[model samples]
Target: MVAWSVCAKRIALGGSRNWILLLVVFVVYTTWRETFPDAHSLKTITFMAKMKPQGANRPSQSIGHPKIVQDGYQKAILLSYMRGGTTFVGSTFERNKDIFYVFEPEWSLIFQTMNEYQPLQNVDGTFQDPVWIHDADETVERLIQNYLYCNISGIDVTSLRQRFMLEARYTKPLYDCVRMKRNKMANCVKNFTNVCTSKKFRFLKTVRLRVHAIEKLLTNDPSLRIIHMIRDPRGIAVSRQGWQEFYQAKMTFTFGRVCAEMLRDIESVEKLPPEVAKRVLPVLYEEVAENPESMVEHLYKFVQMPYTGYVREYVKNVTHAAKDNTVGFSTQRANSAKTAYSWRAKISWKLSSEIDAICERVYKKVGYLRAKSEQVLRNYNISLRDPHISGSYVDKFRQFRIPP
Candidate 1:
């Protein structure tokens, strides 16, 4: 007790070095409790010794619900890179009435940052250089956490007023309410919170955040799950070529970064503790496209959501369009399976080979087969996907180091 009193006094006169003393005190208390199992008085003394007096600044707690008590609600993030077919995947959740879906909540922050920084752009107006933002990871995490917790006020009011940010079906009420009288906005936010909290599932799809950025959320919130979507670099490159917003002088640098990010994300997931890691589901765009129904079923099972006939029909309708929409950002597909590899038909041999070489490590890690010749590149019959290779293969490649 005397020793604990001394430690407590030292803690009260806190400095950075006091953390070491706190650690020592914790170890001693834990060891003492284990040795003397019935030392109830010691436990109380230790607890009291650690308590701070009034007016002391408390340590900030992690945002989100405790892992043990999420109250049967599920929170999910469809974490992917841009042009990675997230829109198609996110549509599944969006169409579901039970889910309160938020589409790219981080866009507001990214938009604001881009406007402030005035990042370098290509002749075509594409962001050629990366934008550096202060505390980007922290800000993104906070935005996501606020949305998951339904703390609308924590999000910027400017973001809330953006029509694009509120495009999710569940957010339509708030969108309409925001455009009305200023006084009514507060009431709308409250009503939105009520609706958000009442849902069985809360989902957000973000292309801006990497897998590591959300590791804290997974560690702290058992209900939070990650659908880590990755697409073939070739396909992504081809897709970007069609999109004006993503046009560049050449795609080599951009595509290289995409693969690198994917590799890093895979490695990040591998390093997570087993319990936390299990909450992340690594999905391939090709696999999902090839077998939409089956993949959707698996995805639904992974998240513990029921696979209803309605969802099945929705998937069929979306994936089996009569004509493929040529629009850059369109999610509609005439034949989803073919669309997954349509890049083979569109990409030149030179570009394909270049991308193949650039993303070779990524291909091996994620189990994609590289084309050896122009004929093979254009051949739709020969699948680029390794039948044996799937997202579950992440465990097998952890020993390999990412190239510099």
Candidate 2:
């Protein structure tokens, strides 16, 4: 009877141990499935691998362990205004295979709020005024956080699609990582974060957000650098005015106001302390447009990227196209060098003078000529028609005029 009781007790204990093991496995699987779900399923990974660049034959960098990952990635933001040759500068980063480039992620949120009347809601679900939504100091902090994490949960899908398209060229590794099934869902999260965080260089390009919007990012993130691209106010004014008819309904301010914003943007940079100012590199559009190769080389050095033959060759092709001026939209084409001065021919002397007057502070600060040569003005037939600046409003030059 003693032997029989000992054997029965052993059997009961063994059965309970097996049940407990099975329960643990079940819980782990369920939690993982809930976390990642179907977006990164095995089937999707298989399809994406096949769709990856033709003849490419390498597995993605492992998401193996967080401790194993290196921590010296450089982050950069292209702070710019409309028609400031931002695209040309941004294209350089895009061509480099090493950089994980995010083009205007802020556009989907910032511009949408300004252009549309619909209230924007924060993560907390409270509806916010369109203009005031992103003005809060916390808004840009949240933007930088989301951008670094490679997460797009807060952005509107439609705005992202319309403004910036993520091609297969950059997203191959992201797709490839979903193939790892050992740790399943944990791998999915870690792999995505690892892939993004492991990159040596990460760039975010934005023409919409002001320097003040991202001031905190400079103070907090030691790796973060700001490339503030400024064009002559005359050029920016001309570009915005060119789009006047198309954006008839959206005009909320006069031409002087447009120039005021340029000064305000420069002031935002000036307000930064010397330590913060050291991180900001101001690029003049004229310098870049005139000599893209040299400017790009200098910029590459500033960002700590080695200037390679690949980048040089790309610059040659781009500048050559700009010199040739083959396309209608110079900004879109290879000939941005020529486009930089194209504004000089388009705007009248009076309008240019108005922009220079309103943007005098910025011009002096950036070392730009306040006005074009009188000879050049004569050649371009500088006459002011006093056309409506936007939506039946005339230029505010008269209102803000200073005594000569």
Candidate 3:
């Protein structure tokens, strides 16, 4: 009787264990499906991103132990030469759910309060870390995601730089550890690079990344893949309106000026040793806008990654898809910076000289022109009337300027 009772208990326990195992498997399967949809499922990638506002915060959630994963990615690094669209793209990448992205070494410049033993609030509102890093899981992730918040408002870059400098001085060993790991990430064919470089993180200790120390990152990260996105300046300058118009921002320089600078930078590259070209690929923005699908596929190929048909489909659908359900309609998505090919219809002889000139210059470069009176498709260079030349709209520019 005693033996039978013991056997019965053992059998029941085994059944319970089996049930628990089944439950664990079900939960994992559900999570995998929820976290990564059927499409675009792969490892993290380094793609060009624009400077946009960060998403609102959600309740704290972590599928993996964020601390361990954070430590892993913190070692990864990203490096890009200026005009590589690092300012906007890097920030976007840093805000990703699956990756850890640190801004340029100049990050110390943007996060001054981080210098204190505790998180202190900077004047324009940034918590600089005196330590190389505060909390592996939380602080670093928050800083990357909130980079844009510092930009949306005025920011103070000076204090952040001080903290960065201080960390370099006192925590030199920790900084070196960070660099060594990042180098490992950068050299690998994957987007994980340890040392990263960019023109600026926007200069407020609260928001900006720094220009100096880029060489240090490069030296530390030798196998960095240089990805350059060369967009025609004509279209880029009017981008004061950006992806959103209500948040219009007149750039520090004109489109032509910036574009000229970009071209000059590329020209100097041709001066580099021939072997250098193998490390870089210049992508024309016009070509990207016209046929983003194939162009991005070409980029993936250049990077030695397989550009699956799904990637082609996704890039194209996103790039060329109508700005909204109102693709033909202009008044949508609040800011309304989307001027399709029909924007010329809104322009008349009465158009202001500045506005008309801006339009003509952009149209010329964007391949849009009123041919004697009709617009038609044109090439990337030698801007002409292009009926299909519907470039991004500069709506807020109209509001900020004297009515033309």
Report, for all candidates in order, the number of backbone clashes.
0, 2, 36
Give the root-mean-square deviation of each candidate in angstroms: 18.9, 20.4, 20.8
Tens-digit lDDT track of model 2 for 1-404: 57646655665588987666656655865754543333245455356445534322333222222222234777788878776778778878878878877776665455444332333443233544432332433544565556654554443223233324343235344334434445343344455456566678888777777777667667666667777777776777667667655433333345456556667766776677766666677666776776788878877766666667886888778777533442322434456655666677777776667666766665555555555565654453442222233321111211221111
Candidate order by decreasing TM-score: 1, 2, 3
* Tens-place lDDT digits, model 1, residues 255-312: 7888888888988988999778788877788878988888888787777766678878
What are the runs in model 3 whose C-alpha is more than 4 Å off?
A: 1-222, 242-253, 308-310, 320-404
| lDDT winner | 1
On lDDT, the stronger of 1 and 3 is 1
Off by over 4 Å in 1: 1-69, 114-132, 181-183, 389-404
Judged by TM-score relative to the true structure, which candidate is superior, 1 or 2?
Answer: 1
What are the runs in model 2 whose C-alpha is more than 4 Å off? 1-70, 112-137, 151-162, 166-195, 241-244, 247-254, 322-336, 372-374, 378-404
What TM-score, over all chains together, does every model reach?
A: 0.74, 0.62, 0.35
lDDT of 3 by residue, 1-404 (tens): 57646655665678987666656665875654442222122222112122221331334333122221111112222333333333332322332323223344434323333322322334343643322332332433344323322221122223222223222222233234323435431122112111121211221111122112222222232232244454333233333333344322443334334444443444444454544434444443444444444555554444343445554445545444455433321122221223222233333332222333444544443343433422322222334334353331212111222121
Per-candidate Cα lDDT values, in order, are 0.73, 0.58, 0.34
